[model samples]
Target chain A: MANLSIRSVSKSYGAVSVLDDVSVEVEEGSFVVLLGPSGCGKSTLLHAIAGLNPIDSGTIVIGDRNVTNLPARERDVAMVFQSYALYPTMSVAENIAFPLKMRGLDRKTSDEKVVAVAKLLQIEPLLGRKPRELSGGQRQRVAIGRALVRDPRLFLFDEPLSNLDAALRTELRAEIKRLHQSIRRTMVYVTHDQTEALTLADKIVVLKAGRIEQIGTPLSLYDDPDNAFVAGFIGTPRMNFLRATVADGGKTLHAGEASVDISHLATRLEAGRNVMLGIRPEHLDEKQGVTLSLAVDVTERLGSTSYVHGMLPSGETVVAERREDQPRFGETITLRFLPARTRIFDAQGMRIR
Target chain B: MATAASDPTRHFFQPIIVCLTVASVALTLFVIWISLHDLSLMRAGREKFVGLDNYLRFFGDPRAMAALWRTVLFTTLATVVEIALGLAVVLFLDRDFAMKRLVRTLLLVPIIMTPVVVGLTWRFLFDPATGMANYLLSLAGLSQVDWLGSPQLALYSVLIADIWQWTPFVILLVMAALESAPTDPLNAARVDGAREWQVAWYVLLPMLRRALAIVALIRAIDSIKAFDLFYIMTRGGPALSTETLNYYGYIAAFTNFDISYALAIAIILTIFTNVALLTMYSVLFPKSGER
Candidate 1:
């Protein structure tokens, strides 16, 4: 296993800069996920790491050697692409054995390794079949097998499971986790799905507009985001933000007709200062306490849990999970927010007290 | 009335058509009657019902057999040269470049020019003493060549001129196929660690096989019955070196007044063309069930 270090990488096409001064360190035997929306430079970063695209300025170090100028073959990195990139002309066995042949391994050893990887991915029966004959999940397995046969220093996956259906995606997600546990190799995965990044990564790098917004463990980013963008991007239903004014010696945040107690907050707060308060939907409860009255607009019940999408007194939309499915449309109910579960951000989107 | 209205085949030959058909039949019969008035002359006034004697005489003639062989040789050489040049031009223009649009438009100059005009132009350029081709060669101290004088070199010279004029037809079609090829597989090849040459050879060329087959079919069919260029340039002169079947038919019917022999040769050429076309179709559209 080798740690991959990217130092000050930048890329541009003509005048449009795609990746600017991006740097990250992927520890050995760890899963590093680059997460972002489309056109946000996540795939470009993965391509740069795989040596498919040349960066304007950067040093890409795989273990001890700097592979900044080396071609993809010399870098000893295998990539699983979004479309699974299995050679249509070759059978699964030949596709898996391609990298081994490229590395000058003998025929016998290459076949043995191909067999081993096919078995690991449970695609042994598909060895003789072409990619077109297989289903999407099967194609994905062959793509991963092609990467595994090389046993390279680092493995790169660019949305390898994006083409699979939701059910198949879950199945392959668990399979990949188990594979990582068994092989314990350094892998850099790039995806726009936050769930994939949260579940599969040892360290998640959230990006926006070609810049790294936050990099941390999943729970850390979930519990404590650095800015409004990170807080909004990291969670499932997305963190709810409300415009509020600090008042009463900074002990209260008044938003429309409701006020939230922030007296126990350790960070400095000033009166009359404008700020944004964020709370996750799961943290909202129906118990009577300091409450914000909201008019229920719709409740989407997903058997055992329901999401009450409603408007708060401030006219801002908020989503709250109803554990017992008790809320109905047109009902105005007061939803309680725990003091410790709230996060505050200044007008500039930076987190504040 | 209902039975007559429900008959589906009623429109097959609605009348006013039957009267016209009878008139056409009578006219064709009268023309055939006048044309066959001197049919005995085709058999040297020997007897009626010649029974394939004209065809037999054509097969027995050394000049006819030589013309047949020369036609095959020219077609083969011209088709091969045309396909190779077309494939080269296609591969070159497939990529994006500064002057690609301009070059593509310019390449159409040769293909769009009338074939007869192109042939006449090349004939003038290949003239022995005053031609530009010989002028350039003389400047290099090479002997001036009689491009259409020698029976051996005349066919080859015509083949060169035809290749120059028609290779662009193949290039335009093949270039379109190459440009729209899926980018996913190519990128996958690179990420799978393939060299650029390998990607071009294994992935790209195989993907272009269907287009290449079409180009070959078109060029071959056009080359087999090539007449206008050959007739305009040499008129089967310099000892009948470039006398293809089309030109041979023209000579036998018009020049030698052997209409029966000409019709027999035309029928034989038709059979050859039909077989070639069938073979080409089967080769291009094999029942692989890809659809």
Candidate 2:
């Protein structure tokens, strides 16, 4: 396995920049996820790592080699495309064994490796079938088999499970994580799905408008995001941000009529300073010290837990998880925020620390 | 997209199709009947039923045999050269450029021109003494070569004219296929360690197989029935060297006053074309049931 290092990479199409000055380093044998919305250039970064896309002025290094000028075939990398880009005319075994054949491997060895990869992917039964005859999940297995058979320095996956159904996506997502754990290869996966990033990545490089927003571990990004974008992008049900003004010598937060005790904050606060108080849904419970009354707008029941989307006394919307009860719509529900769970950001969307 | 109703016999034919079918069937049956007799327009009403004599005469005639072989050679050469040259041009123009649209529009000029007009223009260009071809040869310090006058070079001259006109047709269709082909597979091949040439030879060209086959089929059929160019440029040539099956049949009826024999050749050419096309279709598409 090899570490992928990208330095000051920038790419543009005519007037529009697809990837701005971006730099990220992925540790060897670690799963690095590039997460972003559409048009955010996460796929571009993944392509650059695989040498499928050329950077404008950046250097790409894989292991100890500077692969910035190398073609994709010489880069010692294999990629699984978003559409599972299987060779449609080839049988499953041939598709999986293409890289080995291209490298001039003999028939007996290639066949052995193909059989091994097929068994590893649980696709041995589909060895003789064409890609067109396989389902999306099976096609994806063939794609992954193709990449895994090469024993390359790095493996890049560009949303390989996005085309599958919801059930298949979850199954394949978990299987990919398991495969990563077993093989311990340096893999860079790109996806817009936050759950996939949180579950599959050891480190997620959140991107926005072709720039890196934050790069941290899954829990670190979810618990301590660097900006309002990362704070909002991570986690299900999203985090709520309320505009609050520091008061009482930075001891309290005044957001309209809603007040919060901010004395336990990690960052020193000054009086009259404006900041955004970020709170996750699960952190807002019914039995915390600092209590606030909110008018329920809607309650989304997700079986074991219910999300009470409501407006605080300050007229700002907040989402709180009701573990033991589901609040009725249009009714006032009392929710509490733990002071330690609150993250504060300044007006420019940067973390308050 | 039109499907017949549950009753298998009803076709729901449009009036135009109904008229076309009746005309085609009647003409075909009349042609077959005429091929069995000596129905000469110059000697009307003195005709006698000849049965299989005309067919036997056509097979045994040396001129007819040479014409058939010449047709096959010209058709094979014209179709293969047009496709190969057109593919090269398409590959050259596949990338984006400032004047690409104008260039593509200009390519349609050759295909849109009438074959008779194209043939006439080439006839002038092939004129031995005052042709542009000879002028270029003289400028290059080479002797003025007879383009159409020499029997050896006459067929190839017509073949060149045909290639110049129809290669653009192939280019237009193949270029469209190249444009519409998904680029993801190509990129995937490269990322999977395939070189550029390998990618095209192994993946890209195979994807264009059906389109190329259809174009070859069309060009082959067109070349087999090509008579206007031969009539306009050479009129069966200085030594009948450029005479193809279609033109020879025309000459048989119009020049030799052998109507029955000409019809026999026509019938034979039709059967030959159908069987050849069917064979080609099966060969090109071995697993068509999957598609």
Candidate 3:
């Protein structure tokens, strides 16, 4: 196990800066996931950590040693590429043993190590087959086995499950989690998939563009997002937002067709200001506190639970969760949100309590 | 049905088309008949039908056997050298460098030049008394060796010219293959901790096997029938050292006036070339289960 410290890492391609002054500390044996959308530089950060890409400015310390200038082979880390870059010519056994061979291990010791890794990865029967001869899932295991046989200080995975189908992704996600538990090695995984980050990571580092948006556990980010971007990006079927002006009605919000009773946020409310109001679908009740009459537009029924897409008379579209026996499309329905579940974003898209 | 007949768009027999097919088949049969007319002259023109007489005489004659051996030796040696040098140049030019296109164009000068012109140019350079090659060797205080005059060295001199002319062809084709080589496998090999030599030896060479095999097979067939260089340089001579099978067949038909023997050699050579091509194909494209 090893701890990793990245200090003010920066990268640029000629003139375009990709990562800027980013720093993070990964504790020993921690599973840290870097989550973001496309071109957010998450994969670049992972590659920088794996020493596959050189950072223009930074010191990367691993296990009390500075490895900033070390080549990838000497950095004592193993990376699983999204493409599962298994050597096409080598059999599964030879591919696994390649790193060990580079380290000057004798044939006997390396073969034993390969066999052990194959057994652990459940790829023993595939030892004699080439990469082209195997299916996608089997090829992934061979790649994992190659990484495992190295026994490096850190494991870096760059969207290793992205190439797999949905069901296979789920299966392999569990397998990776189990492997982490058994090995307990420090890992830095990069993915744009929020679900994978939420399920597998001890800490998730959400990024936007070239900056870190927030870093926390899954529930922490879900319950208390720092900004509108994090709030919108972290959930499925997404949180719904309503555009309206905030005005003082004694101790409650007075805006839109209906005044959302926000007496709970009276201390934080400012009079006569435009703000964005957000509420998650799961937190909305079909009929009940701060009420808005909705003209139902579309209802998506997923057996036992459903999503209702509707609009206020003011033409503000919103999605609300409902049971199967909910209102049909083109009908009038009333939905409400608990005052506690509502989130307020000021004019600049900054979160406000 | 009566209206269909009145349409005049249907014919029971298309007379003009029938004439065309008969004309085409007649033309083909006429060509074959004229080509085989002299074949009977070699077959003894009797019921005897001495099956393998000319073929046996071709193999039995010492001068012809010598030509056969020389052709085999020259073709094998020249093809090997051409492929080896060609692959090296291709690998070198495949990298990013200044003047790459210019250099490649310059290298292609020999390949695109007429073979007879290349041979003529070298023949003048190998002239023992006045050629620049002998002058340069003499400047180095080395004794002047006969390049085209000696039976022993004439074939070697011709081979040098052929290699200079055709090795660029190998370079061009192999360069195309090298440029399109997949980047993923090379990157994977680097991550898997292979050194530069290992990457080239273990990864790249295997990928190039098919391309190199194709180059070798094509060059082999081309070199076996090689004539223009030998005709322009040594004229199959000093004492027939560079006389290949083609040259031998030409000499038999024209110089010795043994037209029947020459035709027999031509048939044998055709069969030999076909067998070589088949063998190369099998070697390159093996069964699925066999590696």
Candidate 4:
């Protein structure tokens, strides 16, 4: 296992830049996730790190060796593609042993390593089956086994679970986490799924439009976002943004038809200034800091807790979490949230302290 | 739930199926009937039932046996050489290059040409005295060689003409297969620490196996029945070196006017071709249970 450092990496295709001056540092044995929506250059960054893509300007150092100009095979990195990219004509055992065979390992040792990886992946019975005979989930397991058999310096995954069904994705995601815990190898994974990033990553790097938006621990990013985009992208049910203006000499915030006292943050708010109030759904409680009324739109129940999506009197859509009583559609409900739990962004979407 | 007569789709297809069955089955029966008799243009009015005599004579005729051997040799060599050369060319052209579409278009010229034209063109090129082959040989300080006149080189000269015309056909098919094949495995092999050649050998070639086998089968079938190039270029050659079974059947029917023997020869060739191709097809596409 080795640490990887990407310095001033930039890649462009003719006139379009895919990765623009991106840099990331992943500590040895840490699981770092590159998380973002599609077209965010998250996969491009992972490919760059794997030496599959040549960056226009960057020096990538892994274990004190600069691999910026090296080919993928020379970089000692194994990548699990989103498509599972198994050698179609090869059986599971041969697919797993391909890297070792290419490295000129002895036949007996390669066979043993293949068996060990198959056992680790719980695919021992499937070792003789060709890829076409395997199901989608089984194929991915073999793909992971292929990457694991080599024990490369770094493991890279490009949305490895995106192709499976929801249940299989969760199962394999947990298996991948368990595998990482057992091996403790340096791994860099790329995915657009925030939940996967939050569950499996030691550090989640949230990217947007070919640039790094925020890089921090999963909880840190969820609890303290650097910008409105990061705040909205990191959370489930999405963070609600309400346009408001400072009033009462910065002691209160006045949205369209409702006003809430912001005495706790009066120092940070200037009178007559416009800002966006960011609130998490879970942060909106039935009994806390300030009261707000919502004209109910819908309620989505998940057995224990329900998400109450409604329009605030301020004319902005908000989702509030409720535990006890469920509210029906078109019912006005009162919810409260701590002013300290809210995040304020300027009109430009930049966080204001 | 629909009976055959009541089904509209089946009604539309029935005439086509009937026509094809009658065309193939009736023709084959007529050929078999004629093969059983001693029918010849030399004695048109005295035709009589020969009852396997023509078939028995084929086994003893040294010329017929030699022609059958020649046919086998030509078909096997043409198929193997064309597939190998075509695959090599396709691999070279797989990458990006200037005028790639133009080059591909140029490769189609030979495939689209009539075999007769290809035969005549190669015949002119192989002329012993004034041909381009000898002129190039003289430029390289080599002696003039008889490409088609010599009995030893005649069959191979025809084989060359067949190869030149059909290798492009193989290229077109294999290239299409290569383009449609998933590139992910190739990339995976590269990342798996395989060298460029290793990736092509282990990953790319295996992926192209089904396509190559199919092309080989088609080329073999075509080579076995190859007639135009032999007719136009060699015409059974100076000493019968290029006398393939098909050409021998033509000679028996037209030159010798032995229609019954010629029909027998054709029937034998058909049976041989079917058996050989069936064996090839089975080898190329083995059953899953066998695997």
Candidate 5:
């Protein structure tokens, strides 16, 4: 295993830039996840690291070697594609042994390695079957086996579990995490699924529009986001943003008719300036710091917790988590949140620190 | 078990089925009946029932056996050469180049030309004295060679004409297959540490196996029945060197006017072609359970 360092990487296709001044650091034996929505260049950055796609400007160093100009095979990297592209005509055993065969490995050793990989993946029964005969989950296991058998310095996964069903995706997601922990190989995974990123990654690199938004641990990004985008993108039910204006000599914030006291943050607040108040759904409780009345519109009871989605008097939507009580629709409910839990952002969506 | 009375779609298909059965089965039976009779165009009214006499005569006829052997040789050579050359050309043209569209359009010229036209053109080019082949030989300071005049070279000259006209047809179909194939496996192969040549040989070619087999099947059937070129270029040749079974059948019917023998020969060629093609088809496309 080797640590990978991407320094000031950038790529473009004709007039459109796909990866713009992006850089990431992956520690040895750590799982680094590139998380972003579709077309956000997370996959492009992963491909650039794999040397599958050349970057316009960057120096990618794996361990101590600069692999910027090296081809994919020469860089000693193995990639699992989103489509699970197993060679269709080859049996599962042959597919797993292909890289070894290409490197001129002898048949006896190659067969032994293929058997070992098949056993590790729990696909021993599927070794003689062609790719078309297997299910999607089985095919993905074969693909992973192919990559794993090579034991390359780095493993790149380009949304490998996205094509499976929801239950299979979860199963394989856990299997991948367990595999990484046992093998201790440096892996870079790319996906748009926040839950996958949160559960699997040692560090998450959040990207937006071809640029890195925040690079931090999963909890670090969840608990303290760098901007409104990160704060909203990282959590379920999304973080509610209320447009508010500073009033009363920077001591209070007002949105429509509802107002909250911000005397603790008055030093950073400027009077008569527009700001956004960001609050997580779980932060608002029945018994807490500051009370705010909401007109309940709907309540979703998910066994242990219920999410109360309501409209504020200020004409903003807010979702609050309730552990026991379920509020009636069209009724006004009072929910409170600690003032410290509320994140303040400027009009441009950047955090105010 | 839906009956025709209950299935409305069968009403539309019944007439087509009847027509096909009548056209194919009736004509074939008529040919078989004629093959069993001793009929000659010179004495058409006095035809006699000969049973299997014509079929038994074929076993002892050295000329007919040699013609049959020639047909087998020509079909195997043309089909194998065309497929190999076509696949190579398609792989070479798989890349991008400036004028690729123009080159592809130019390649279609030979495929669209009539077989008669291709035959006549190649005949002119193979002419011994004033032909382009001999002229080029002279330019290279090589001795003039008889392309279609010698007993040994006449069949091969016709084979070259057949390859020229049909290889593009193979190229066109294989190119279409190549374009439609998913590129993910090829890229996966590259990342699996395969070199460029290995990528094509191990991944790309195997993916294209079905298309190549289909094209080979078509070329084989056409080569077995190849007649227009041999008729136009050589007419059974300087020493009957280019007399394929199909061409010999034509000579028997039209030249010697032995109508029943020619029908018998045609029936034998048909049976031979069907057995050969069926074996080839089964080998290429095995049962679904087998690899």
Candidate 6:
């Protein structure tokens, strides 16, 4: 296991920069996930660390060595590609045993290691099957086995579960978490799936436009994002943002027919300043202290929880989490905001501390 | 032509087989009728039934046996050498280079040139005293070599010309296969600690095995029936060193005027070539259950 330190790493293709001076510190035996939307350079940063894609600048320090210029094999990093990338010609055992064989390990020992990895990944019965003969989930397990058999210093995963079906993705995601638990190696994973990042990461690095937006624990990032983009990107049924103008001499925010009192807002703002008030769906309650009201337009029930989508008089929609029942479309509903949980971003998108 | 209305997509084999069977039966009847007779160009229409005499006489002829052996040797050598050399060139030029497009275009010149042109060009180049081959030998302080005159070197001179003309054909085929093969497995091999050569041998080459087999099959078939280069360069000269089966069949019909025996030789050569190629194809692409 090794701690990975990426310092001022930047990569560009022609004039377009893909990773602009991105840096992250991952502790040994921790799982760090780079989470972002498409074209956000999370995959590029992972490739840079793996040495598959060379960085244009900066150094990558792993353990005690600076391996910035080392080739992928020389760096002792094994990758699980999104496509699985198994050798189609080789059987599962040979695919898993390849790295050990390349390192010149004895056949007997290598075979034993292959069996151990196969058992770990629960792919022991598939040892004789070619990759083409295996299903997507089975291929994923074999790819993991290949990476695990190497016992590399750091493991890099490039959206390894994106291609699988939902059930299989969840299954593999949990298995990967367990693998990290058992092996306790430093692993850096890249994915655009926020749920996977929230579930699998010890530290989540949120990225946007080739730059790091925030780096923190998953809950910290979800609860306290650094900017409007980070706030918008981290959660599903995403954080609701309402354009509000300061009113009542810097004491309240007014938007359409919904007005939220800003008297207890953590940050002081001058009167007439414009800001976006962000709140999570579950935080919008009918029985909380600070409150706003909007007319209910639509609602959806997902068994235990319900999502209530309401519309302001100005024709803007806002979602709230309700229980059991929903109001009619024409009915007005009062939603109280948890003052401690609400976030405000300026018109320029900077977080209002 | 007056058959009932039929769905075009659903029943294509009926019409196809009807046409194919008519053509096939007529051709087979003609070949078999001629093979059973003592036909010759000089004899005209005074032909008589000879049964299996022509086939038996062919197996007994020493020249015919030697030509058959020469054909097999030439086909095997040409196919193997051309594929190996072509693959080597493809690998050498696989990477980015300043003049890659121009070089690829230039490589096509050899393949697109007519076989007769290639044959005459190599013949001049192999001229004993004044040709470029001997000129290079002189430059290296060696004696002028008889490239096509000596019996031992005559077959090889024709073989070299065949390779020079056809290796680019293999290169073009294998290059297209290489271009479309997925590079993810190869990149994964590099990340899995495989060296450059190991990645090529284990991942990249295995991926091209099917394409290489197809190119080898084509080159093998082409080599077996090759006559233009031999006619242009050697013409089975230098004590019959390059007298291949196809050329021997030519000699039987035109020079010896034994039309029946030449037909027999043609039939036997076709069977041999088909059997050999079928075996090769089966080996390269075995039945899925057989593995």
Report how closely model 5 matches the true complex, as a DockQ value. Answer: 0.63
Most DockQ-accurate candidate = 2
- Per-residue C-alpha lDDT of model 6 across residues B136-203, encoded as one tens digit per residue: 99999998789999999999999999998999889989999999988888878988999889999988
TM-scores for candidates 1 onward, in order: 0.87, 0.96, 0.81, 0.93, 0.93, 0.92
Q: For every model in order, what is the iRMS?
A: 2.3, 1.1, 2.4, 1.9, 1.6, 1.9
For model 3, residues A76-163, the per-residue Cα lDDT tens digits are 8888888888777678998899888877899999999999999998989999988889988899989888988978888889899999
Model 4 residue B114 CA deviation in Å: 2.1
Off by over 4 Å in 5: A248-251, A261-267, B1-8, B96-103, B127-143, B289-291
Tell me the tens digit of each residue's lDDT in model 1 across B91-133. Answer: 6666678998898898899988998899999999999978888
Q: Which is superior by lDDT, 3 or 4?
A: 4
Query: Of the true interface contacts, what fraction does each candidate have?
Result: 0.50, 0.74, 0.32, 0.70, 0.68, 0.68
Candidate 2 lDDT tens digits, B1-291: 366456555555565688999999999999999999998888989999988888998889999999999999999999999999998898788788999989999999998899889998999998998899999999999998899999999999999999999999999999998888888788888988999889888878888887898899999999999988899899988799999999999998999888988899999999989998899888888876544
The superposed Cα distance between candidate 2 and the true structure at residue B283, in angstroms, equals: 0.7
Q: lDDT tens digits, residues A115-193, model 6?
A: 9989888899999988989999999899999999978989999999999999999999999999999889999999999
lDDT of 5 by residue, B212-245 (tens): 9899999999999999899899998889999999
Winner by lDDT between candidate 5 and candidate 2: 5
Q: What TM value does model 2 have?
A: 0.96
lDDT of 1: 0.83
CA lDDT for candidate 4: 0.91
Q: What share of the true interface contacts does candidate 5 keep?
A: 0.68
Clashes of each: 0, 0, 0, 0, 0, 0
DockQ list for all candidates: 0.42, 0.76, 0.30, 0.59, 0.63, 0.60
CA lDDT of each candidate? 0.83, 0.90, 0.83, 0.91, 0.91, 0.89
Residue pairs with backbone overlap in model 5: none
User: How does model 2 score on DockQ?
Assistant: 0.76
DockQ: which is higher, 4 or 5? 5
Would you give the TM-score of chain B in model 2? 0.94
Please tell me how candidate 3 rates in CAPRI terms: acceptable
